[model samples]
Target chain A: MAETSRDAKRARTAQLILEAAREEFATRGFDGATIRGIAAAAAVDPSLVIQHYGSKAALFAVAVQLPSNNADVAADHLLEVLAVRLGELPPETRALVRSMLTVPEAEASMRQFLDERVENLAGSFDGDDAKLQALLAVSGILGLTITQHFLKLRAFDDVSSESLLEAAGGWLAPAKGDT
Target chain B: MAETSRDAKRARTAQLILEAAREEFATRGFDGATIRGIAAAAAVDPSLVIQHYGSKAALFAVAVQLPSNNADVAADHLLEVLAVRLGELPPETRALVRSMLTVPEAEASMRQFLDERVENLAGSFDGDDAKLQALLAVSGILGLTITQHFLKLRAFDDVSSESLLEAAGGWLAPAKGDT
Candidate 1:
């Protein structure tokens, strides 16, 4: 009985640490954020954070793991992905995207994630430039997601994701001439 | 003669500080970067940095100003902008983009810049969704810049900006059914 309660308490503390870590990472990026800062924000001792998460890199990995979408990157799948991403971005994903360029760990994670997506998407198109086309399409969607979700451009506030996708149909359709 | 040499020396010092400021801002972003760090990087006193640039906010503004494009957002103009942006993102612009979401000042600057461009592009399109279409197109280009330049995705290294632009034709063209 005591062990069960203790396990529950540990899980709760870990969850608390994760929430604080996400906020710190999202605000400061990986390089600027510290375990101590996260611990303080979580209202726990610094050592307790290390105890719960192992290391800063490990914590970041666990914190920023985006929910994987297993579907292939078809037109419908792309729209679905954009719809979710264009709305409020998950704070963890925001932390990863925000820090991807400046921080090595974040960059590695993002590169791995994006490479897989680009590969999956490139296979959908035909031609010598298929990979590049896939990349351009994916990159464009990423930009829209950043504008709406991260940058919060006021001009986009009135526009629906459906409307944006409709406007994007040309890009999402098979590369011009391939069809 | 002494006064003229002093003026030259002062200008040199200011230029050095600006270069250092750009590197610091690029690496750490706006919120993470410190005036002290910029000074140290420039081999100047913190007070000297303040004397030269006034404040961090003022320094950032001076450092990150992109070379203004005077042309309208026509297809040719859009391609020209993308060519420059995709080739190599200026460190200052990278700093602004990297920090835009997390830092209020960067966000304000980026919002102002993008809003003006969206307005200009929207006027060229014909329909209720013109502004939204403009925003999506601009956002996609921004995303491409981030992927190729900032993120340094290895997959994009082989792809020329010309090819990428060609793949992006559908995006840069006026929205379908608008013509």
Candidate 2:
């Protein structure tokens, strides 16, 4: 019973530290963030952070959750959902999008994610033309995400995701000149 | 004659400062960059940076040249030109593209450039749609640059820019459902 209680306590402490670390890393970047700052934010001693995560770099690797395969599926459905959700998002969400574009940690995560996608998924293409098509498809989705969500350019700021997706679906279709 | 020599000397100093600043800002970011470090890289006294640019921020704003309009053409043409230029670039140009995308100073320059495009040139579309189109265009360009050049995702690393441009032009054209 005592062991169970201790494990639970450890879990809660780790969760708190992870959340704090994510916010700090996102805002200050990998180079700028300090483990001590993360500990203070998590309401724990610096030693506790080392105990929980092993090291600052390890904590960061854990904090920025790399989007899983689930995220890829989510990305495929992004335009449809984004259009619906745009009207409902609070101002903070917009700010978050802006930060993701401007911040180094967010940018690095995005690059890493895309690199993985290209390596793993782009191989499905059969021929040179087919590969080019696959590349364009990926480029279109990535472009839409960065422009509409991250850069928050005035052009896309007010446009619904539905309209954009409808256009993308047509553009990304598997036909010559369809784009 | 002495004024010409002074002017020439100042030009060389400013160029050195700018080059050093770009390298520093690219690696360390704006907040992390210091005039002292820039001076050290340029082999000049710290006071020279202040004398030339007034402040670190001011120096940065100047060193990072934001994209600008030539005042003689439409945004569409600008996009086309960008597409062509990007397509024409050699594979070795990936380093430059990566620097543009990942560097904090370069990202800011890109934002400023896009903001100007939306404000000055994205006037063709009606109401909010203009902004949406502008955002989409920028997103498309950025996505292509990152995927093809910076990240160099497999097949894209070796593909010629002309082929990529041909693909993009098709994607950027008006949708059948739209018009």
Candidate 3:
């Protein structure tokens, strides 16, 4: 009984610490935030934070949503997956965008992350303008992201899932004769 | 010489007032900004602003770019025409988006403007989801608007106009069989 209770307590403490880390990093940014501040904010001993997460950098890595390894999926497939996931759009879409606009590091990191993924999407096409085509598709994807999640526009949010996917299909696919 | 110099001075002053109006609206928003304040910032008499542009609302109408009667354009043709206009994207894209984000009136006005246009696009389709589909097409068009002009990301800006038009083709057309 004692061992189970201790495990539960440890899990709760870890989660509380993660929430604090996210708040600190989001508010103060990477260079501006501190480990002790996060620990104090979490109301946990500083040593426990380090013992559980290793370091501030590691904690940030765990707390923030980085581009998934799944980003390697081709552009068409990615759009299909995203359209299907519309009803279950990731919660991080809004937070990441809000933070990216507000924080320099987050903006830089997001730019870098998108650059890599878009390049992968472009690589699939055959023309000299493949990257440009991929970029146009990405623009549509971002529009959906911002409206459905960030702007929360009523026109976008109230869309049925099937209609949303249909709408995405017309604008996000590329054609060989598109040039 | 005096008359010619006076004409040049008048033109320059008008230009300066417009620039100031742009800056003020961009920074402070519609409700939060004032013409007297704009004239002061422009280093011109308040009367000159009124003399040149008539009223604060008139100045806003002149200084900001609203969609032309061209906004009466139907969606598919509008997208094609806009895609062709890529190299000469209107300066108002960034300024309007900035102001829209900052001002409630601007946002509301833009929403109303888009709703009417989306409805026109929806009227062309025969499904119960026509409005929703039109809204999605609007998303793609807006995405292109933001990326190609407003955000000015390197990935988007580097594309040649020919490539951009081609890229815009796949996703913007009204079709039921996108797959």
Candidate 4:
């Protein structure tokens, strides 16, 4: 079946809102960001932001999602892709991360991202300690953000991403399920 | 050497101001925290708080220092102690961390602690990627705080500290200096 122009237009508008929300959340943090401001930035109605995502918290969850992933990507490969994607997050997305950290309003939204975006990956690991494993992975990434991204620790800046990931090799592995 | 009574009283007053500052900084964040408020909490004159430490930022640096350590503890044991200490941070110190994240005045103070406390440990690591190694360790700890402490991931709360630390085995090695 041929796709309708209306469907394409709808998708485009949603994408616009997501991008705008990213900017708003990053710059102002969750407390300072508003639906109206994001709507204005996207050139869409404020209701549309709410209509599509339901609430501010909902909007943030969708806005910070990783780029689409292949369902077929192996578990191990998925981890690599996730790590690289986390490291190379767009500036807006990174801002959203800091916003989540600093703002109280974003707490639920941050948890939503961890559950929807991060926990699914944790489950794929051969582990019963899925939540623990997932949190650990996030810990490494968050720590790296502090060093490699936010603080720009000189030693981390000097190392290639590949070498850094290689070093992260042992740490990234999910704990075995039975254990 | 024998200590003078005046010196002892001076030290006691300084300690009182520090305890008061920790509570103020934690509960109110840097922007909301005031020298007068801290002094009131300590039952001292506001000028005394200033006279003792010079400023709030300098005060925070001294108050949040980890208990104590020397080279005598094995590297692995040190890691355990460090993790435990981070886990069991005083309420005031934890509050100070949130304040640091949210307020500019607190950031410089926070950096002082990170430099005096965290980066020194980073520098002690052996390899060229010492900074990165230290950060990875921090990342894991930060992530754990978000889950176990911040968000209250119940599964994480259920796990014993020992098991959780064991699960974090590979990621926590702070590259041994000169190894």
Candidate 5:
């Protein structure tokens, strides 16, 4: 009974650490962030972080949460959700956009995430140009996200999420000529 | 005669510094890099960095030149150049592609440049959907670039520069319909 309770507590503690780590890493970046900082943000003991995640790098890998077995599904869902959320953002979201554009920590985390995606795709695809194709797809999605969400360029920044998603879905889908 | 030579030397020194700064920032990122490091790489005295560029931030602004002016012309020319370059890269260029995609410094610098371009466009185009449209265009171009150059995705990575340019050029041109 005691062991069961202890395991539950450990799981709960790990969850808290993860949430805190995501926010910290998103704000401070991998190099700038510390284990102690993440623990403090979670209101847990610093040792708990090391005990739970092994190291700062390991903690980061977990916090970033790279796309998993369902890459295509996740990518599609991300595009759809982003298109909607971006369209619905209150006027106040300008501040959020501004933060995303100017913040180094946010930029770093984003880069790390995209790089991993590209690397994973490169490994799975087999062809002379397989790696480049993977890179392009990753770059394209990232480029779109940055331009629409952060820079808020004209036409793109003002359109409904539905419209953006429609366009992105078309581009992302396999075209007849592609094969 | 001596004054003219001194002026020429100063100009040469400034150019060298700027070039060195670009490479360093592209490789090490803004936070990890230092003025002394840039100077050493440039083979100039550290004080000359301050004398020529004033500060690290100032140097970065100048070194990482954004595509702010003549968007249409720059976009067109960039596409052409990239297409040609893509066709010319040796098989070994795969490694370069990997580096660009995986490196945080490269990723941040690329995003920073794109964000600036999108923001500049947003200021010019005003309407309900103008911002969104501008953002989409920027993202599209960036996405295409990453796809073709880094990921080496099929069809795109293997095609000749002119062929790729032809496809991209059409995309960049004003859309005729919703499709």
Candidate 6:
């Protein structure tokens, strides 16, 4: 089929709205953000946002997806990624995590997302407690994320990612039984 | 020197207001809660709340203190305490954590609180990196707390605290040289 300029224009507008929604949600949080606010940021009509995404919750869902296979990264690879993850989180993920606790809808989405990650990680291990072990691993990562991204703890500023990885290796290794 | 009827009534009213404040903050978060609402919940006039607690921030500070020397419970004993910590968080602590990220004042209070804990925990360790190690250890504990307390991940419900304490022991042991 031939490419249509109209379809391309629609895709561009959707992308613009998504980026705007990410910033609005991240700065103001879920309850604080609104359809009109997101639309204003995107320079689009509020109706256009509704036409494209349907509702505020629906737009948020699309805005905050984790990269595919985020959980599949082997345990050792986590340290390398942790170095990057320790830095600023993407606006979308930040929006989701920031709002997850206070907002019921955000909490539901985050829970489902975390459960899927745990299930995937568990598939690589053997034992009845595999899921539990995986859950703990995920929890550790979540803790670090919250501390660095949300809490902005100063203690972390004094240490290098390599040092952190070394310190964390002691326990993280036992959880996986591998490098 | 004798206790007066006037003093007793004042203490009781203060306690009642504190309890209501805890519940209001926990359910509505820092930004969502209001002095009027807290007073209504406590069955008191708003003036009394202000008279006792100068500001909302001041009220929150007293309400959400972690137990004295919470971090002083040596690494090995953490498991025993972990059993208790894993249960539902107190409404006061929950209220603080619920608001920590989005609320600037809450985040500052939480950061200072965590730094003191890391410093206290580091006092027991050796080496220049002791503080960093303590920070990671605390991060792990914070992760577990957030997962169990706020996220309410179902995986935790399936596993007994005994089992969790055991599984976590593998990594936690290495974080601290002792059991």
Best by lDDT: 1
Name the lDDT value of residue B161 in candidate 4.
77
TM-score, model 4 to reference: 0.63
DockQ of the candidate models in sequence = 0.56, 0.40, 0.24, 0.30, 0.24, 0.57
| lDDT tens per residue, model 1, B88-107 | 65677778777776666877
Worst 10 residues of 1 chain A by lDDT: A170-179
Q: Which tens-of-lDDT digit does each residue in B77-153 have in candidate 3? A: 55643344556544344345544433444555556556665667777776676767667666666667655654456
DockQ of 4: 0.30
Cα distance off (Å), candidate 3, residue B107: 3.6
Candidate 1 error regions (>4 Å):
A27-46, A67-86, A168-170, A175-179, B1-5, B31-46, B67-86, B175-179
**DockQ: which is higher, 2 or 4?**
2
lDDT of all the models against the reference?
A: 0.75, 0.60, 0.63, 0.60, 0.56, 0.74
lDDT (Cα, tens digit) per residue for candidate 4, span A1-179: 24688788888989899889888876665656789999999999999988878998878766665544456543445344334435664645565565555555455555554544345556566655666666566555555555454444445555577756664554456453211
Ranking by TM-score: 6, 1, 2, 5, 4, 3
Tens digits of per-residue lDDT for model 4 on B56-113?
7777666555434445433354344334435665655465455544444444544443
What is the CA-based DockQ of model 6? Answer: 0.57
Better of 1 and 3 by TM-score: 1
Model 6 over residues A1-179: C-alpha lDDT tens digits? 24688889899999999999999998888878899999999999999999999999899888776554564556555443333334666787788888887877777777776666666666766777777777777677777777777787888878887766655554454444442
10 residues in a row with least lDDT, candidate 3 chain B:
B170-179
Give the chain A TM-score for each candidate. Answer: 0.77, 0.65, 0.61, 0.58, 0.62, 0.79
Models 1 onward score TM values of 0.82, 0.74, 0.59, 0.63, 0.68, 0.82
Name the candidate, 3 or 6, with the larger DockQ value: 6
In terms of lDDT, the poorest run of 10 residues in model 1 chain B is: B78-87
- Compute the interface RMSD for each candidate structure: 2.1, 4.1, 4.7, 3.1, 7.2, 1.8
Predicted structure with the largest DockQ when compared to the true one: 6
- Write the residue-wise lDDT of candidate 2 on A1-179 in tens digits: 99999999999999999888877765555555689998999999999999999998678667665544443443244343323224442222232233333355555555555555544444544456656666666666666655554445666656677777655664444553433
lDDT of 2 at A15: 93
- Cα lDDT for residue A34, model 6? 96
Q: Model 2: per-residue lDDT, tens digit, B1-179?
A: 99999999999998898888877765555666799999999999999999999998778767666446767656556455344444443321222233333346555565666666656545654554556555565566666765664444666765666776666655344332222
